[model samples]
Target chain A: FATMAPSSSPVHLLFRQLFEKESSTYTYLLADLAHPDKPAVLVDPVDQTVDRDLNLVKQLGLKLIYAMNTHVHADHITGTGLIKKQMPNVRSLISRASCAKADIFVDPGEKIHVGNLLLEVRPTPGHTAGCVTYVTGEGEGQPYPRMAFTGDALLIRGCGRTDFQGGDAHELYKSVHTQIFSLPRETLLYPAHDYKGQTVTTVGEEILHNPRLSKDEESFNTIMENLGLAYPKMFDVAVPANMVCGIQDSHA
Target chain B: FATMAPSSSPVHLLFRQLFEKESSTYTYLLADLAHPDKPAVLVDPVDQTVDRDLNLVKQLGLKLIYAMNTHVHADHITGTGLIKKQMPNVRSLISRASCAKADIFVDPGEKIHVGNLLLEVRPTPGHTAGCVTYVTGEGEGQPYPRMAFTGDALLIRGCGRTDFQGGDAHELYKSVHTQIFSLPRETLLYPAHDYKGQTVTTVGEEILHNPRLSKDEESFNTIMENLGLAYPKMFDVAVPANMVCGIQDSHA
Candidate 1:
């Protein structure tokens, strides 16, 4: 009774979770099919899969209102710059704290509108300084409106590390608890990056089963700090490119 | 008497075949240990492995003289630029026909000397207009120098396609027969790239078993034209960057 999905059209909440193999990034395309224009929003577009994502949008005949990023990724170049170049009117959005130049600097508690749907921002930084989780459709009238685009802030059974650029374990814990875990227990969790092939989870599942962050804040800090991660191969290239919205650094 | 591979110093020919997983590329590192100063030459160092290669070079305490290429690749960025940046004295060498801006524009019959070893250029331009095989140790009074860096022109039981970038089937067939097959049957064939986990082959084995180019010229042309090859994904990004000697095309 809550789902606004029309009987005539099955694509009510038109959604696609696309994957780019190189960086293990998941790009989310959400469209409100109830509206005639089919206004859409894209999250975490990867530069390498620009054509792939654009083709999907074109095939769906959706007017892309915004191309958003959860954070300034250090693993792959973002497709925001390229998407804006392709779709002149599409606004590129990222957290104001990310320092990444985009068309719109989104802030915590801001709502990005696409047709009748709204994406609410919850600052869940820790993977990166500017990380945020985009929550949508949590009102009384939608059955499946509770979904979170949890950037690198939260993974299926894991959490983002606090070792790279501006990462802090304690802050991440607070952010996750107050911002993400505080959401409805059944809210679907969709992270920005996943390597283990597990795609979606829930806030309750993460709170109970997220091996890395389900522990105490101190333990989470210890684990995040001791990941012994090699600097990502694309770190040098991705960081600079992402700073300018995925444009490669010519000066480098 | 000719074989200077003494029992005391078994490092007569310091040889290592490295693999770059992203591009499925093979890099050959050859150093002549007979001389007091171990002069090293690297063929096809990939961009991602620059640090790894540099660390290896540092660990070995070897003086790198030349960073060469079999051809300008269309798969991965070359490490030539990074190598040059790290080792200012190292010369970057590729075929003059490649139009790649490098320190040395090597031509057919040119010998690149590294301590006591020499890399002789053999024009093998079937794979690409600028493709060339580097043959080392084909002269008298030299022991253990019968090896060929065949690039993509000749692979293990296969040959590169004559589909793009000035590729010519007839030229490739003739070049392989005269330049590569004319070498000693026992000559080791080290290709620039391989996919099936094949590390090395021999002139004798390839000449007899090379399914694509072993037949007559017409047969070779037929196979080359009908391979149904997809243009490499990195063609656009790699070609321009390789032309500038492996620098990433920041403008792209």
Candidate 2:
């Protein structure tokens, strides 16, 4: 059986995976192409690429509805605030647990929709206390295979570092096992950042090959503890700015 | 009308857009997931990222039948030769007009198929005499709106520099106007490279917004001539290596 409906289906969804070079972040643009208005949502947008992203949304004639973050990022500022400023009609969204400023704050199990397309928010806090995975195909029956936008919780072949931002390796391991891995084996997993050029991975691939998360919980926690990673260069500037949806002092 | 079939269709195609950071080149992986064996093809692979590409193919349990190039790239070494060397069963492919060494040389109007998915070759030479665009959804009632893998001939809001490697402004103008702009308005265009992190654009969007291509032929040519862009940093090493399918002196 096919994992998702064909592009010719009655209710087709338009999807694009955009990249931010500076932070190696992946932002996703999605909408119901079948809808008359083409209402769209952007997930994990970076502040630096706001112009490029907004221009694209305009070029495609998509109505920008939401600029959302999977978590409060420490590596790069979120584009949500900047986006809302330029387009006041646009709303900023973040997990309620994130304690961040946004027009809309969602909690675990909440369903966010633009047209018929939906994102089911699942808390997957590991890399950060408020990180969440946005899984597609929630609510009634959506034929598409679920896609997990695993913010910093799960990465390709690796999980995010759990050294700061209230990160807990144990929680992350549990989150992935319960919320992400349990999806259908074909569920496509897109991470927020990738140092390598890889764009996407699948649940089956990660289950069999994820170097860190595939290990037992104890080993996974131990691995996360000894990563010896450096503090993120942009942490100081990014976190505070992102706390208020990336407006920073300039907005004041 | 939807641009392509939805993902759940009986003959759903699996697609992933991979990036190479140094050159901002985009490599596309395509396969017919509906086929039991899942034969796959990679377009415009880069040598520096061959390991990641091959590993992905293996991870997906895809049998990669061909490694092809849209043109002999001047910006980076083509991964075709290296890919074939690693997977002997995989054939290297390039355009016959490109004067490049490859196991399979395709010409305009030819169709290459892996399972039921197809790429209809369209000569889009401009950046170079051999450049071609691989357009999907060709032949016999393929319901998907066509997608053009336009290599350097047309980029998002831009076109490739027409200053070297047999570059010709006039030819590019004519090629895109006749072969690309004429496609269905909703057809998606995937370029070989994008520096600004854009993943894709539709025919309608590019037709109206491409700064150079949207202008008259004479004006377009003038702009191309005056780009004043620096010669590509990799031109010296990339051109010769790409000519022989990216296996440098070491491959011998």
TM-score of each: 0.49, 0.92
Best by DockQ: 2
**Fraction of true inter-chain Cα contacts (below 8 Å) kept per model?**
0.00, 0.84
Residue A168 miss distance in model 1 (angstroms): 36
Q: Which ranges of candidate 1 are over 4 A from the true structure?
A: A1-252, B1-11, B139-145, B247-252
Q: lDDT for model 2, please.
A: 0.86
Query: Model 1: which residue pairs collide?
Result: A137-A145
Off by over 4 Å in 2: A1-11, A139-143, A250-252, B1-10, B139-143, B250-252
lDDT of 2 by residue, B27-119 (tens): 999987766679899999998899999998887789999999999899999898788789899988989999988889999999887777778
Candidate 1 CAPRI classification by DockQ: incorrect
For A1-252, candidate 2 gives per-residue lDDT tens digits of 145453223446778888999999999998877667788999999988989889888887899899999999999989887888899899889999998888899999998877667788999988888999998864344436678899879889987888888888888999999999999898999999998888888898899999998899888878888899998899999998898887674446
Best by lDDT: 2
Query: What lDDT would candidate 1 get against the real structure?
Result: 0.80
lDDT of 1 at B118: 72
